[model samples]
Target: MERELSRTLPHEPIRWLKEAGFGRVRLPREKGGDGASLPQLFELLAELAEADSNLPQALRAHFAFVEDRLNAPDGPERDRWFERFLDGELVGSGWTEIGGVKLGQVNTRVTPQADGWSLNGEKFYSTGSLFADWIDVYAERSDSGGPVIALVNVAQPGVERDDDWDGFGQRTTGSAPRVLLMRGSSRRTSMTLPSASATKLRSISMCCWRRWRGSAARCCETSARA
Candidate 1:
């Protein structure tokens, strides 16, 4: 499938994947999804990667965001976000910056104002942002310098996306630099990960690694049987 589509540089496979209900594979059955287990999701991802490496890599943020939403406590926020996902909205990530800083540290600033808040930051390697309906940006709160994630509309004013990625390969992923500027007031919504502690984060990372390993093993077994 990827070989056939390789000739078209701007072709977005995600649209087809979403239409096939691949994006909602991890959501609960009650939430209009297949309720795929972690291993199942990773196995499907591995298969997709085997077909087109760039597709899986570009959609990594989207998969992670879906998992986050699924793990979120039952509330209006989770329900609303899940509904958006079911509606076929794609989300990209802008968590990493160009600087060689630590993983969790963010230089972007989000300041509260009289009317709302302001966001100012520059991000690099913003994978999938150009193709996404919404971009999740990670920044620091101006008052306390705490980490916060904000979901911003792709067409929001003062948001700039540059398709200047110079990589010799996977150029179709649209991994480029993005700038978000809020001169004075901008309506922004912010959220923090439930397990934001360093220890918890590390544990979660290990869990994900294990799940992927298990998925790979299962795939190998299935291939052997075939």
Candidate 2:
């Protein structure tokens, strides 16, 4: 999938993603996935990134898609709303904020309402948001406590998109700014997941070893043994 995506992405990976079941690997079995372990998925992501950074992103989109559904309460609501993601119908990420708001610096706020919740804030660098069915947004509490994630329906009424991702490279990502209004009934809850590690080491290791070593490998091996 990585090789294929590396060559075709910025153009055709989405179609392949839908067809190959790469989009459903993390989803529940009932929701059309193999339910693979995280280690396996992580290794796959490394390989995918080695092929093309974009591939890992599609993989992350798939991860977030299933994760959001699995995190939700199981019932007609969960089944009805999150089924498309398991089916590879949507793709996107929920990180990043406008105006250089770093992680733990969330400005988005989620307020409790009668039925569900209401969310209001602007988010940026949301990769693949243009093609996303929903976005996993994080908001800070003015009172106190940890950050909370809100599963926002971007297709719903009040959400606005400001796609301005015009990078020199990675031109196909379509990442941009988004403004979400709090008119819809949304699920406001915290997600239980670990933070990802630095990609630099993996990036460096792969870049170093990917090419054949006529003399470098021998010298390193001899030095280690000595």
Candidate 3:
């Protein structure tokens, strides 16, 4: 794992975690998950971070997605998602835009089309995206200008990710600049996430502080087998 980290992202370890059913730790066993408590999950993350801190960061969105779905209303929509989690699929993030875009502004927009929807824009600091099967996008409705969350499949032709996150220490975090073009018609309600970027500031900062101090590994896991 260390050797691979020198050349590229730790795909092996990430894959290993998925096959081990780590992403479903927060879920109930009845739902085909590990049914781990929140504290236990954090402890596991801390251990994982000690081995390779970049890993937990790469899986932040995946765990967050699981948590979000757990609170969703019980129904077919939620049940199908639980199945995906058990299948080891992962979700990444796409809520931020860099540059002078300002604090309260969003550049990504989702417009309605004859077939479905059109998602267009770029996102920076897209951590965990390189290995993501799906991207949780934050966008605005062109028609009503209301905020909405989008869950876009990464394999779609319209989606693109670049290996450009060269941050100081979190370089190999599977993070990259993501571009969503929606060349043709995309499905209705593509990868949508909350526009509550501001609300997460404090929490993100806390995690960063913990990471810097070599403790408090709070999220995600990996794929490669060692």
Candidate 4:
């Protein structure tokens, strides 16, 4: 599959996967997913990685976002995001920064205006942003300088996806840096997910991390047995 993917550069594997309902593998059965358990999801991911490593890496953020939404308290926000996922809209992330040692701390600024807010900053290692319908950017609130995650529409103004990834390999994963300049009214652009007191968020992160490590270990054990 990796060789096939390499031969088919610029192919739409994400779309193919989504069309096949791979995106909803972990979503609850009530929410139109297969209700796959964490171990099941990770095992599927590992298998996909064994076939084509870039496929799983490119879709990592999407899976993480799905997990976060699944773990979120039942509310309007959760419903809205889940509905979007069910609607076949892909969500990508742009959180890391250039020359930044700290993880999850972004230099992107989300400033408020009378109409809405403006997002201004550049992000590096923005994996899977280009192919996604929505981009979740980690930014600092201009008013309080607090960290926040803003969901921005990819088609909105001030968003640019550059194809300047100079990496020697995995070039088709769309992991290049990108820039976003979003300006809209509060109603349009205020979909911020607060992380200040994200106990649930932290729990979800740790859970996924453990599942990932366990999946790798299980794969190794299986290989040894084989």
Query: lDDT: which candidate is best?
Result: 3
Cα lDDT of candidate 2 equals 0.56
State each model's C-alpha RMSD to the native: 4.1, 8.3, 6.0, 3.4
Error of 2 at 75 (Å): 7.7
User: Which should have the higher lDDT, number 3 or number 4?
Assistant: 3
Worst lDDT run of 10 residues, candidate 3, spans 217-226
**Could you tell me every candidate's TM-score relative to the true structure?**
0.78, 0.59, 0.82, 0.81
TM-score of 1: 0.78
lDDT, each prediction: 0.71, 0.56, 0.73, 0.72
**Model 4 spans > 4 angstroms off:** 1-10, 99-105, 179-190, 196-226
Enumerate clash totals for all models, in the order shown: 0, 0, 23, 4
- Per-residue CA lDDT of model 2 for 1-226, tens digit only, reads 4444343334466666666766666666766677876556666656655556665554454465455456555788667645665556665666566776554577777666666566667776676766566676756543454566566667766677665554444544546445333344454332332223212332343343333232444655898999
Candidate 1, residue 94: CA error in Å? 0.8
Better of 2 and 4 by TM-score: 4
Candidate 2 wrongly placed segments (more than 4 Å) = 1-12, 28-31, 39-52, 64-82, 100-103, 141-146, 177-226
